[model samples]
Target: MTPPPPPNLLHDAFSADFEHELRFTRSVLDSSNPLLEDLLGWDEQGPRPGLIAVVDSGLHDATPGLSKAIEARFADPALPELRETIIVPGGETAKNDSNVVESVLSAIDLNRIDRRSLVAVFGGGAVIDAVGFAASTAHRGVRLVRFASTVLAQLDAAIGVKNGINRFGKKNFVGCFDVPVAVICDEAMLETLSDRDWRSGYSEAVKIACLKDAPFFDLIEKNADRIRERDIDASRPVIHRCAELHLHHITRGGDPFERAEARPLDFGHWAAHRLESITDFETTHGEAVSIGIALDTMYSHLAGRIERSQADRVVEVLRRLGLPVHHSALHGEAILNGIEEFREHLGGRLTITLLDDIGRPVDAHEVDPEVIARAADLLA
Candidate 1:
């Protein structure tokens, strides 16, 4: 009888649904606009949702009245009650340190922000990623609203369904996949960005265009100068299109949470992540991505996966956009180590995205280190 009991087996399976919305608007914190009220669903029944906002320290310094604006925006009875506003370090510095994440978590706890409450993160991609990590972990889960303040955040990082921070000298080593309650891209906030920061963001747009839309690539190529010069009119359409494409990939690409092995959207990210770490994040992510894209494009050419003309075109576009196609840090063991790190992150075989032509992406299970070395040399 004991032997028969040992033969018994149990199995179970379940599925959960996820749905969230994103908004592209201007001046989300402006008192006159009802975007915040609409996003929090204040018109509906229940108690007003508690809110805790975390602002980027750099941004706070740039915009002195930001706290007042935040207060005024939530002052309306129809909006969620503003509980506490915490300030955090901006840029990669925010992600490299664990204490940044802890501070946000501590703020969430001290504010008594529950799963029903909202954690509004206002800053560039790094700040959003760090704060989103905290919100996702606190109370097992908490809704996050991203007020994307930079071009990079609006078009790429804030639109992402995943959130993360770097650890162990690795990029995005600590993180989780959790969609935010909503993402708000405030176009007005982009005005205060430095020219360097403005140029830094378009690399992501180039990445998406290279992977999914040839026509979009042409548009970016055409407007590269205006965008680099802070021409908002030229930049706005590019931002909208890039954000749209990113959202489409997340919602329709059937791999929003990256359960699949191949990541088409990460066309140039393998070396990009490595470049950032090796440089101690002196190079911005978008800048590293630009160089990564150039490296991979040249690799694709050298490996006979794509025509050299196409690869040249990619490099040219990045250059025309005021983005770096090469960096001194690319020549190193650390950059090559990224392939294994990428494979570990993918959680199976090594799958990387390459291109046969603009907008035509293919997956490769293995890459030649010799070819990678040659490509880096060429970029150098």
Candidate 2:
């Protein structure tokens, strides 16, 4: 018997005056050869486009050869002239730190950047978010590309065009919608990740599965360990499948720009942002998201939106992955206050993604404050 072909991946391209393209490919950067020639529509006959590759500083020492490879590949006179490569540290601290922004701005002057030039962000989710935010704001708007180097970045952050920066101790408080020209996902980079980093990204994979694909959820539960171990062969299909699910919802024309209304796509992010803001970004994004998912699940139960067993199941999966599903470190009152703050932050219009049934999401705009309080009690 032959194995079945992998599911056909689907992505909805949002039609705008600006072009946004998302692609997932293998071996993004190969042997000092820039893939941009084929990936970004470069030909020797045409004028060379300016390019900047932003990498994480943490990988500077570990992957010294990567930067040199990028420089050499882009330096080819036959191809586009690589303007300069900026390397910034990866992680929550790096995203919140303003110094990285300063360094990035210095490397590529906003006045010099235009639609012809491209900004390639090569790091984890935080790095991509920071770079995307910078590129969007630079000169009003410039073309951006994501060479996602981590699992989380490749599957989630790299696909979305939302760019944002932390402000006043808040997560992604300031930002805009500037989708990238393309996103390249290279599985090769996963080999160097530590176990913790691998698991951190796994939370996002699980989140996608829970929100959209129930079959994908089953796949994740069964292959959790293989993925955490960075088994690329076993994990590639899973990553591709999850990306498709996200693309399906995003392209459905349900406010991808996030201007008019909030949608179910932000299922667990409401509480997640508050946690990161309050903790001063001490918590990993994925870890904080796990906690947020649990809190929301509890709230769903209290609101009579979902069954108690469904809530418990969500908590169980998070726990098995070694993610924090409860806020034991913080008091109940603090958690309740955080939720209230979250509500206020959104202008009191709580757009929550609740389970009408497992694998089915119902968007609720007005959730009772009493229900939120009762949910906090359960966590307490």
TM-scores of all predicted structures? 0.96, 0.86
Residues 1-380 of candidate 1 have per-residue lDDT tens digits of 45555546877898678776778787777767778767786644787778999999878888989999988888777877899998999999888889999999998898888888899999999999999999999998898999999999999999999899999999999999999989899888998988788899999999999999999999998998898888999999999999999999998888888998898888899999988888889899999999999998998889788798888889998998899999887777778898999999989899999988899888999898889889988877
lDDT of 2 by residue, 54-137 (tens): 898665555769988788766666555677877787887666888877777766684355667888778888888888887877
Best by lDDT: 1
Task: Please report, in order, the local distance difference test score of every candidate based on alpha carbons.
Answer: 0.89, 0.72
lDDT of 1: 0.89
Cα RMSD for predicted model 1? 2.1
Candidate with top TM-score is 1
Clashing pairs in 2: 57-88
